[model samples]
Target: MTASVLDCISLSYQPLWGKARSLTGLALFVQPLAEPPVPGPIDARALLETIGETLPADGPPLFVVPQSKALLLDTLAAVEPPPAPGAPGPRFATRGAATPTVVVPSFLLQDDSLVATGVRLGRDRGLKLVWQGSADAPPADDIRDGFHRYWLDLPPPWAAAALKDATRKAAVGQQIGPGRLPPGHIYGGIESRVLMEYCLDRCKALALAGWPGEDVVYSLRHQAMQPSHAVVMATLKAVESDRSAETVERILSEDPLLVYRFLVYANSPALGLRNPIESVRHGMMMLGIETIRTWLGQQVPYASREPALRPVNAQLVLRARLMDRLLDAGIEEALRREVSLCGLFSGLDLLLNEPLGVLLPRLRLSRRVQDATIMRTGPYGPSLEVALALESSDPSGVQALCAAHEMEPGRVNRALLDVLSEVDPDGPTI
Candidate 1:
């Protein structure tokens, strides 16, 4: 055996977040071998013996053995089963149910490969094959230390770069996993961070490609909440190839906050509507497609902080909303939706204490909004002049955009006063 030769495989696991309290239910990460061992023919007996010997002597530890696909199947076959009825198996499971099995991946698996074998066994025996390094359940501290030590022990530079690159790649891929959004606040842990970054990248790419803002916003919502990258990629491709409103609505329905906001905007007086649009689809229909796209662009800041400078934030959202409503050529529903969304999200910078780019995704906004936040660098940046101009009591900027649009600034001013009256009868409209 050479330096590349395995002394024995050890259990290693990394969670997306949180500390592991026990080893029983957690999936184990198989620490990587320091060197690439020779590709010799698979040997089941030798591998099992090596694993058993390497199992930690003390302090509850699970053995996570990695071997060639052939050897793993052979070893599983040779392993002892039921300790006779009324006896317990080494792992826990309900009566007649298969024990849980974890399958951690360092790289993409080959089809019909080693992992596939384990998956087949899991399905047949009713075992659960969980990916260990998930965002929801972080690795235990002790386990993380063990893996870090093992990684550090490897040869310098090359080993370090490889580990870093692998983690980044894994994080990028993990943006879309096949799991449901953890219940409660939609995001706040490891998963949210990865998804936010992924959404940002997508927004950047779309902006560079000159994709429409509405399309981009819709895409982010579809991808950000999904469980896996494969799904996100598939949905993105579908939407891009065919800009379908129905698909976008289905994705938006997943988040309650988004739904409520949409409904509220759909029914607002800004829409000048006699009746409310009750359903998401009906609301979408009542609001023209282009305007809805604009709304999506503004949705990213839904979770933004309620600005400390309440008046300032209000003016920001208000100005942007007014611009959207005034400039829009769509139906009342669409214009109202766009203006309200812009108003709601425009003051995000004041609240988040960061640039719009840094704060937008935290709002879990659609891709369109992300683009407007980042790439709309021109004078017409969606929330740019409007937000700033609102602060100027003179309202010169508002006068300018209104002049450019050939609309009377008085009507717009009246609209502002109207909204302010509703917001606070005692407060003066500056």
Candidate 2:
């Protein structure tokens, strides 16, 4: 079969988490590396036939967003409702044959003709139509019965919060129940545990499109490691067992908090170092395995036992690895490792409760890494930007960055997937 347009494109994604941070689906953004020279819109055939091929059959549902109306219509046309039970179908079809959820941009709602056609296609084909707009964004003046069937986007940012807050106040006044959600609302970009609880527990939203891990980790600030420090304890054992610097760094860096602490301790006045520690490798060498072992021993008793911390730390480390993958592989091993550190420490600001400029400069990172991480400039800036773009999982943002940097989108997407596929010694990938 001829390759679909997906072959020349880079796809960025956000794993949509439902209540309790459960994996609901993966939202894949389509970005074309090279624009079509022909006078036509992009194709959506590949979204079904090509892009979906890259994902696991049994994995979460795939949410594919296309840039053009033609592609949107085409996608709706391509997917047919599942066959009736006992009907003829491919062998193992039920095992890994998850169809993608087609996302129709809010702009499409503006055109009555297009919206009508899209709704018809969706209903006829039995495709899941997710309207990417406010929960109330369906046409108000000329409401169509079919519009109600479309899955709504997360309520406009703050819209839900505003309503929820108002309801809370009203409930306090009249003693009414708190939930005000329209049944079956789909929320995205949720970043709060409080809001998550309201939506999931009270309003009972169908699914949420965000992760509250960062807030969970932030609440853990100034707290010692909990009992979940088993991983940390194991790494300390590695150091005690005379493990190589490489092995220890690999084990220790798995915990973002530990990595940050190591750098802080290594650069502390107690160490009396004129120059700052550059990498985990350097920190381990300067401090010596014995001292490092002893420091870790002190931490294990109080290390974080929070399970939520695992995924957060995993994501930070993966972002770092993705940045390293974005770098030219033929580059010197040392420089490559330095670039990876920039990625690793990209989240340092979140961990340390201080801006990266304040935290990183004290460590005396190389000017290039400093520029890339803090200033988003110099040689390594592009990789860091791309890494962030992927993290944000915005297709247009990824497209804009790739175009600005003259970087290939396909290569960047591949790099992200590659890093995500890597095996983590400490635990599961996020």
Best by TM-score: 2
Q: What TM-score fits each model? A: 0.26, 0.75
Clashing pairs in 2: 225-302, 225-303, 225-304, 226-303, 226-304, 226-305, 228-305
What is candidate 1's CA lDDT for residue 252?
52
TM-score quality measure for candidate 1: 0.26
lDDT of each: 0.37, 0.66
- Across 1-430, the per-residue lDDT of candidate 2 in tens digits comes to 4444544566776656555444556667665545633335556554455444454555666676765566666767676555567875321233344566677767766765876577666766555566676666565444344433344555565555544664464434575455665546567666666666666666667666646777776667777434238567878788878877787777777766677677878989988978778778888778887788788888876776665555556666767888888887688877887888788788777766779888777775689988999989999999988888886645778778988998866667767655543433325224
Off by over 4 Å in 2: 1-10, 31-34, 37-43, 47-49, 79-97, 112-115, 139-178, 182-185, 212-254, 266-277, 281-295, 305-315, 420-429
Off by more than 4 A, model 1? 1-313, 332-335, 362-368, 375-384, 404-411, 425-430
Q: Write the residue-wise lDDT of candidate 1 on 1-430 in tens digits.
A: 2421132222222211111111121112232222224454434444333333433222222323342454445544433332445865543222222222333332322444555555455435533333223233333442232121111111244334433433353355465332222211111111122332332232111100011222223334432321222222333343445557767654453233355466767777788666656555677778876666666655543433221122232244345444454443455654344334444455444333347666554433445444544565432354344444433313345545544545443344333333322332112111
Residue 406 CA error for candidate 1 (Å)? Answer: 4.7
